[model samples]
Target: MRIVPSEISSRTRSAAERSVFAALKAIPDKESVALHSVHLPAHRYKRVGEIDFVVITPELILFIEVKGGGIAFRDGKWHYGRGDGRTETRTEGPFEQASSGMHELEREFRQAVDGLRGRDAVGGYLVVTPDVDLPPMTTYEPEHYLGSTAYAGGRGLEAAIRRAANHWRGKGKNRSALPTISAQLRGDIVKAIRPEFDLVPSLHARITDLEATFERLTTEQLEKLDELEDNPRLIWTGGAGTGKTFLAAEAARRSSARGTVLFTCASHTLAAHVAGVLSADSIVVLPFDRLDEVRGRRFDHLIVDEAQDLMGFGHLEKLEELVHGGLDGGHWIFMLDRNNQVLAPAGYDPEAWKYLRDIGAMNASLRRNCRNTKQIVKQVQRYTGADLGIPMAGQGEQVVFAKVTGREDEAAQLDRHLDRLLDDGVAARDVTLVSSSGDWDNTSARLTRRFSRIDRYADTIGAGKQRNRITWASVVDFKGLENQVVCLIDLDAEDLRGRLDAVYVAWTRARAHLWIAVLPGVNHALRELGVAALAREGAAE
Candidate 1:
């Protein structure tokens, strides 16, 4: 049937609808088939369904239900919806509704045909949705009819009609004439319609899928890391143990071939760690303060490892100048922790948080903690608001809590615990000691001198100062850093109030194991925020 385009409204049908309508108009017909968008008779008992397109033919009638949403098949059902401000409600399954509509159309067409020619005729149901990558249909059972893309092409409708006519012709004992009738239908429709279906592989789609797969890969590798092509800017954020450092190293290694890649960290320790992983001649790992001096030199990319500590707009502006000014046409990779900005400068406006929303950023959350058990991660999440995204499967280590009378006693208790853990085969290198107060140098010094482990300062831990031994560091210095085991000491301070963010940073630093030493007056603003006791209790099995 000749499908007319003028009958349908351009306003009502979406972009996809117009495309489908244009395709349908190319089909030739024995008789003119008019397409219409008519409101069905209202049902007081049930909600009336709005038919997207209706085709009235000489011998048969067809009703089409269109869904423009990208169709997805799941759990033995098809699902599709659009973002039209209305919450989509799946009333009946698409297959069931299509079948029912087909049956109704057949009955209606029989009546219409009988009134005109005194004979029952054939009818069909069509469910049309464009731009859908539908799965191959294996069955055409009574309740599971799937429309193919091939049917929507030049000879699609005619081919469908021929199939229907063949079945009817068999029932009428005129099976020999079925072939002739099908040929006539095809000859009439196939020539007039111009089929313009393009089937080329989309490069953009392939690239997107590849990027998703890269993000989900489990193995540690330096290959297949994509550097931004134009206006390259990069931001990487992950909780502790998410391999942000390793990913940064990989980025450095891949981009080093293009030009000089400067690896800078907010602290020296992180820079040192990254420096150890890179070729000394290719990368210049430095602290954030030294960035200004290196501005005259040209670099292709800047990889910032401990970006969480690069707080305040001033620091960001300086980095931006170094990037957009010095390395005018370069890329950047920033590794950040949301809760890691503990030492916000005096009068730091909260509005500066908006700087975190800049473009060229990727969020790669490390779901599995290679260090801590699921129970420990959960407990830590409860306290520090770190969503580990891990479901508990079984029992794990219990989180232990002891309230000390003072800071000294707390430090001693922490030392005793460390001694016991070391005796239990927990290497000092596997553990990190964190605290809010930087004055814990005395405690850290005692631990360091006794155990021969270095005290890690977050600012000095990044590059050129890589210490393989266990270390003590303040939460601020260890913001974007993580370890297998962590012992938080001297965190229970009254003066260091409004530092729940610091507490969160310290708590998340431990990947596999965590130990918190709380002083007697440790019930500070952080504990009030449901972070301290909650995270500790939650982490404990």
Candidate 2:
């Protein structure tokens, strides 16, 4: 038998449905087609009903009802085990349920199609209990029901269905001649039951799915949290996209139950994003610059995200004052990406590492790259030499490096890329444009003037949105954040030495797709990263 959908389309929670679906697939007759999970409206039945399986053959159409697990009939109630350590009680048995649904479906067919006035009932209902055997009940004929033992004893479900169809075929008034269902009618019946259409998700919806996968914590992250149970003063070191922010937020949330918790990060934008994630009253989330907000207040536990940035500039002294017993005797967790410190080399001091070691703070490494796809991770590792570890995410689109001649040409290329992404279904909010230099506002202004849909990034990376417009952000401000699509602008090979770290940061920000608009002279830099510029150059407008 051919299935309407070659495979089950929806994720079904019912074990019985799944079992029946598997059995239906084994039907030997190639001429028959089975529609799984047919839904019915509330017309004659006065309530919505669903037929588990609809088998259409040349002889008859069979509406099947499946009941799984431990089953019992007692005190006029049907009790069955729900496979989740729970028993569900129902008043209506499977036989009556299937019969009424079949009648309703017949009525619907008569109303939906034309010229079928008083034709004989060519189909009937069958009850299947895959996990239990039912005693011969006085209300229904034995031919209409198939229990677990029937498969081993008889020729199986297909044979039982043939027998049931023959039994129903002789019941009508014109019993002398058997009625045959034509192929055209069977196709009509399938369409009437469930119309077919392809539902392709929008670009934003697709990105949302990818984002959900990226947000899930891996076993390593969970084990790291478990390690904290033994020692709370461990420093977690990992490369970019190692889920440092997610780990920090979760650690702060868990620590809040013990006592007061302080969750601070070097980036104010990152702090705001973390604050939005953790809302417990005992947890205080803020940036290093905002330590005065909690002056004279000491927390029982401190979780520092982006800790590499806080090692110098008197930031450690401030954190020491805020955390109980300072760093030496306090309960604290520092989550840092050592490679990210290159962005702020002057602010990171080597003495801080010695201090952490001298104090015997436990250390752990998070090696999984949970954010970027395998393709993006490869490029980032190839270019930046950052050990992002294994790429947990699967294959993704290849990184694109589009060559441009000048600022005007670069802006035009960027606009065209944005249009293509949007046309391909990516939402404007899911894409971010990062400027390589400090002139982010100027870039935003220039781009906004060129494309009205472009605007400056105003809110924290992960929160808030300006619905229909794409955002432009600075390379520095968007650290510790990510987006579904990232397009790095103002890439100059002449100034590559000064801002290689910034470019690395921008490259790693993309979760699924990354596009770099390389300036005219950046072909040499592209070659170093093992990427060739696209054959077509942007036309200057």
lDDT of each: 0.53, 0.72
Per-candidate TM-scores read 0.50, 0.58
Q: For residues 1-541, could you state the per-residue lDDT of candidate 1 as single tens digits?
A: 4443232331243655555565556566645443433221221111113344445554334555556666666666655666474434464655457557556544443444323234333445555555453554653332122254654533354555445444434555555532321333322321221110101111111211211111222322111132233236666565555556666765675466456778887766556555555653667778787787787675667877766666567776676665533323347777665434323334343455455444444434444444356766666566555554443223556666666677567756776777888899976666777766756545534543354555455533443343445677877667656666778776656634755567556776765667777665665544555655555556764
How many residue pairs clash (N, CA or C atoms closer than 3 angstroms) in each of the candidate models, in the order given? 26, 1
Stretch of 10 with least lDDT, candidate 2: 532-541
Off by over 4 Å in 1: 1-224, 227-231, 311-313, 324-329, 340-372, 388-396, 444-470, 523-527, 531-541
Total backbone clashes of model 1? 26
Each model's Cα RMSD: 19.7, 16.2
Candidate 1 overall lDDT versus native? 0.53
Give candidate 2's error at residue 434 in angstroms: 0.9
TM-score of 1: 0.50
